[model samples]
Target: MPASTEQAVRVAVLADSDTRWKWGALTARRLVAAEPTGFVLRGRATPTARQLAETGVSTTPPREVTGAEFLREVRDAALRGEGYDVVVLALVGGTVRAVLQGLSELALERRPVIVTGYVGVVYEKLADGLLLRHGADVVLANSRHDAERFRAVYEGVGADASAVVEAALPFLGGAPYTPEAGRDTLVFAAQPSVPATRAERVYLLRRLIGHARQHPGREVLLKLRSKPGEHTTHLEELPYQRLVRDLAAPPNFRLVYGHMGEVLDRTDLLVTVSSTAALEALHRRVPTAVLTDLGVREVLGNHHFVGSGLLTSFERLDAGVRPEPDAEWLDRQGVAAGGDAYASAFDAARERVADLLAGPALPPVSPYYTADTAPGYLPGILARHRLDVDAPEARPGGLRRLVREAARGAYRHGVQRVAPAIRRLGEL
Candidate 1:
């Protein structure tokens, strides 16, 4: 049977929740509901998929295909006698590279309108996905800065860039709770994987304990992602545990495991080293601080928070330093600007997809092309995939080599710098 335009859109979700799959599920639901033609979600054992299914959304088990096999499936599905007008690939990390490579190969035969939802900084991995040079018709960003970052990284490589306010899991509607008066408690939410850097961990611990001491009357809660495993006790190994124990008795300081939302709701001020929780706190209008000396200041700064002077140095805290709130910036970040922004973004995405389907076929580029044409060819390549990098690439070098080096650099830097910050912050 011939597939008709009126048939429900078959949207295959490539999801792994530890990454951006959770966000992908949320976006899928909204997209399916908005259009009369529903969508199908695919994932390998995702809680979000189950939730969607419970809500009566259609879902398919993620085929247990290796990265290469997955792309082959996408190619065949798009080109098979059956007409599948659009294929949305929701990917993060290395998976995106594989999908793009496959798309490029398939582009040699027939052009399929492919839309991709990337959860992290694509520029950081641009080299891995040479096919991205084909251009993504629409690129989504977790934040405006991320969108700008994408543009800065991919310009000239191919594809125009635009921002799609990342669709978030529907865990909380609007602000989850109103700020309570007389709430003087501070919560440090930590993820698992205790920090391995002795110096950094010690510094973070001292700052946290010092903050507790400064607000003597307030309760200090340490929330852990999971209960300490066999090798460690959440509190004992902590660098500042001894100091915290010496300064304040057990009752003043509490160690909590699990039930993050419950803890977040009651938190008066959220202190994070580099946890995304800071962003969540911001969305909730909860006063939050990111310990700067830990090397995550750039990320926090991009969010437009005024410098808090709250470094890892306890001496600074003892001096009664506090972060100054940028009222206007906070207001801009907190404003929900009605549903108009989201609606407009969705409309734009749909239009891009429709245009791709209706447009002239795109030409294929040789995989063996030299580095010189890499950036110039990228815009067209990415266009086929429906992603947009809003800014131009930063490096003056050839796009291919630049992307490759950038990806390697991001991997190394993220592990050496960002990962430690995340670990330390999560431990808090």
Candidate 2:
């Protein structure tokens, strides 16, 4: 029997970091007619309180869970005959695969409609990421171009491409760009670890400061992702915040951190190396530029904007250049600068989800990797999340569980603190 329309749709989102949480929660809203519950995976990039607040998701705080704890929750929910109607796994490819395997072992009579996809530009690990996310009921492609590429990758690997559904970046929304009288703000959206080196970060910082000095009339806002101690979707080895201290910045220049959409409201020209904020700005028809100051390299991810027409340099920007995005390129990338197309961007995804909810019970998630397929490969991915499909009884309890938590904390400390310190020493 199909699920009755009278009852509200129950949706849940499991995401690892701040950006993913924002993407997943907003996506669930577009896919279903319900307020989706949010869950954050406790990890190295588990969102700080301020980070969560800045996303403006909801007043209801999200529950934080480990891989083991989340799996257990799913099992418990299944046992209680209260599984979610839809679940968006907003996590890395490996994490998604592990969760799929873990859920499959539960052997529930009904499984939630699983959904997963990249949060932004699919610049790296195309094959590896796609394969890991293969078994989701809806592998959402954020644009028409992405949908084609996703399908091609799956079909090339002889896997089912039926799940690649077209969608848009759920968080892409703001009032259309309009100039504020006498206040032209230049917002440079900063990423945490794109440049990854101290020198590169320092150079970018100096350039930004220089730009502020050159144009005293324009308010140059360096939009940051997180605070000094906070972690974002990516790790920051050499934070702009630390580097900017060494330079004497102008009064017109300032560091700001808030919702990108809120910042975009005041932005006349949005600039970045390769941050997803470029896409958001374009969607709002804001004049945007992807910096080529570091060279248009794949590692910098600015290469993703090859034909975007928004790719330019600080030299061009400093000389008062605000490049307009190509309409064809915008359509391909699903920015839909024209309002109508973007309004209906989620139509296909919503339809697919509705059919699944109204259909029979979903089968076990069948990820691309398995013991028979990738014997050596599958186990390591599962083990990283402490998920052992073969040995459920091996999970620790009581005192052992406490010790495990302590160990996990120590590991996060090493990654967030000790590792960065070692990298800084190497620079010296």
Quick one: best lDDT, which candidate? 2
What are the per-residue Cα lDDT tens digits for candidate 1 across 197-284?
Answer: 5565655556666667676777888765422111111122443332234444445667764434556788877776655455566555
The lDDT values for all models are: 0.46, 0.86
Instruction: Mark the regions of model 2 whose C-alpha exceeds 4 Å error after superposition.
Output: 388-397, 406-428
Superposed Cα RMSD, model 2: 2.9
TM-scores of the candidates in the order shown: 0.58, 0.93
Instruction: For model 2, name the residue pairs that clash.
Output: none
As a whole number from 0 to 100, the lDDT of residue 330 in candidate 2 is 90
Error of 1 at 267 (Å): 2.7
By TM-score, the best candidate is 2
TM-score for predicted model 2 compared with the true structure: 0.93
